[model samples]
Target: MVDTVNDDTELFTIGELARRTGLSVRTIRFWSDSGLVAPADRSTGGYRLYDTGAVARLELVRTLRELGLDLAMVRRVLARQATVRDVAAAHLRALDAEIRMLQVRRAVLRWVVRSGSTTEELRLMNKLARMSAEERQRVIDAFVSEVFEGVDPHAPGAHLAEAMSALPTELPADPGPEQVEAWVELAELVGDEGFRQRTREMAVAGARGGEQQPQGPDPERIAEHAGGAVRDGVAPESAAGGEILGRLIGPELSAEERVELADRLATFTDRRVERYWHLLGVLHGRPPMPPRVPAFEWLIAALRAHARDASAS
Candidate 1:
């Protein structure tokens, strides 16, 4: 049976403290031995006896331990080496980091489970989730640098390099599955040689003034007329296509001008480049712009067709 001390001056056995605090006898003994709560005196029989103050100390230690504080920190708290408030503030920062890690792991697992991800993809997702903000930015920077390496910085669309590298420094603390998927795809895309080369071609052409529009056709008119034609299912070689062309480019273009316009549109029109911007937009939380490449492509086809007809006639 545990013995109890009724007054602050009276003493209680470790067993009594354990029963009152709901801690195990072994736990109380360990804390007592660790110098956290020393006995007030020893009985003639050599049994350890603790005063009532020991009860409050033991309870505080138990609370601290249950809150994930380590023994060293608990020792510091007991020794008055650190204030409880100071230790608590430090522990809160540690907890925040742990929470962020758990959130990243949860997002990775959720994506893996939903996609039936392969072993390679699983590895990739985990790796990306663990990357620091600087490392993630480096991945995009390397891709942009590779694509725009030799292109003149003064070139018309050279600023596109900056825009292309605009991934946020860090993913949200609790990212959605789509955000994770977008990051994974973005990682894959930057490493594709074909995609790199396509962007390089567009950049190089723009550097040489190939992307600049001459006095031939107004772009807004082409977007309206040609874009509407494409939406209404007008074939580039059909009479309806010809009508749209007239409204866009006018009827007086010589064969040479038509060829030149086709080349200019081709220089700037790459589907992959458009896709890169679209993916970046998604990552940046922007509303998706309606596709303009299809419209430009239709206009290019119409220009080439009219050029052919003029030459043959």
Candidate 2:
């Protein structure tokens, strides 16, 4: 029943307000006690009574609460100390960060399942995969910095070191399984002391050779001729391999020259180093390039073969 405070005004008791607003009497009493939905008057028996404006305020408070706002935020909204739009914008940024973290966790779980990772592997993968973009970049930066620490910055390969350290500005907020796997593998690769030493060797060599134009066989020619021989399964030490090597670096190269060229090639051609570039390609959303290390390995072996044959003769 409505309490007629005047001819024009109708007031509702707690029970009546609950019936009208579809809220519980206990909830209405709590909000009233909390000063969010204050009573407009007191009945003769000392019960809480609300006017129509209170009913509207109660509905607004319920809507805000249902939207995940705490009582304090709702109070601010009700008091006009903060606008709903401003609160919503702040809440959205928080929700986005939370969602991104969950997505990364999901991706890590997927990787764990697919790889059958051990406890230790899973722990490491999770730690690497969940790092922020800056943290991920720092891992690469540290690796590159160590590898090129004493190497000359003006070296031809110094640019390559910079390229090696490149990471996307940020990882995709919702990364796929492959991306997670790439990041984990990359982190491990950079941390390997053996790989770091190999890279440093290449950097130092390139710095030493930077003063003169490289007189080595053309890379394009090597990839074409040597790459073909590798695909065709031609034995590196066989006669046919000699013909390909002639077309590659020219038969005029002395035995010592062949050995020197082979050593230089071997220093830079590493499967793990190539794998590093391949993994970086994956992270950068590039299509996979065919492995070039095998072709180069064949070239190195063939050079050693002919050099050894000449020495024996």
Candidate 3:
């Protein structure tokens, strides 16, 4: 049982009600005087008196005050100018936006420290914070449309075009500086002649060679030999390489097949194709895989070595 100085039915003094509600006496007085909350009746001496219901009302008032509502809004709430749920929902959205901005500020500070950034960089970071969700999408959309505009969705090359154009349709209201940098770098990378050529070259090459684009280092042999070479750090052309090669390509398989795989791997092993994938991973919020170029390059040489052995035989 809640110990009340006065029972719910009994008229309690304003001071007693204030103590029960944990509101300061002056605040309770102000609310009563403002016509926001009124005592239930007059006491024996005409002092303000409150009934049990006043305790519940006072609790609601305190809640509104704690939530940063001005008295006017509080009164509006009490009077149903707007429903509490409606006002609360709106405020909740506003708070979410504020929290995102603060997170972005922290990221920008860290980026400034990491890059030894100049004032110009600070300005850029600040500017990035001001971008709305729609604005950010526009930036991504424009870049992607330009890069992949002509690609026919029905064509074999359409997949590459689609990958290049994929962007986050929604960014957090306040995106961090790293997100901003990624956007800028991505825009620059897509525009870069080297990167564009690299993507186009790989796409065109994939079309030219289809699945066999990297032949001698065929899928089965690569996952076996090159994959193992990457794991064991073995040079493809070493004298001991024959053992690894034998395991990968099969001792029964002719050296000519290995050479064919190697030549194909070399054609598509350019770093740009890897970077295109890397950027795509970032857009998709994925962790990255290790580079396999060294392993493939090794496989290419091993393939060539197998050719030499076949020639000598």
Candidate that scores best on TM-score: 2
What are the TM-scores, per candidate, against the unseen true structure? 0.69, 0.75, 0.54
List the candidate 1 regions with Cα displacement exceeding 4 Å: 1-94, 97-101, 104-115, 150-155, 207-220
- Please, what are the lDDT tens digits per residue for candidate 3 over residues 132-182? 557766665665555455555565545766666666754444555556566
State the displacement of the C-alpha of residue 69, model 3, in Å, after optimal TM-score superposition.
18
lDDT of prediction 2: 0.86
lDDT of 2 by residue, 1-313 (tens): 6787898888999999999999999999999899999887888888878999998999999988887789999999999999989988888887887788789899999877787878998888789877887898999999999999987787677787788988775667888889888998989999999999998888777777654324667887888889999989999999999889878876567789888878878888899999999999988989999888898999999999999665565
Instruction: Report, for every candidate in turn, its global Cα lDDT versus the true structure.
Output: 0.81, 0.86, 0.68
The TM-score, computed over Cα atoms with residue i paired to residue i, of candidate 3 is 0.54
Best by lDDT: 2
RMSD of each: 4.9, 3.9, 8.9
Backbone clashes under 3 angstroms, per model: 0, 0, 8
| Tens digits of per-residue lDDT for model 1, 1-313 | 3344444377878778788899899999998898888998887688999887888998889888987998889999998999999988888887976787788788888987787878987888989876767888999999999999987888777877888899888777787777777787887888999988888877776666633734446767777888898899999878788778878775567778887988878877887778878877776778998778888899888888778666665
Cα distance off (Å), candidate 1, residue 105: 4.2
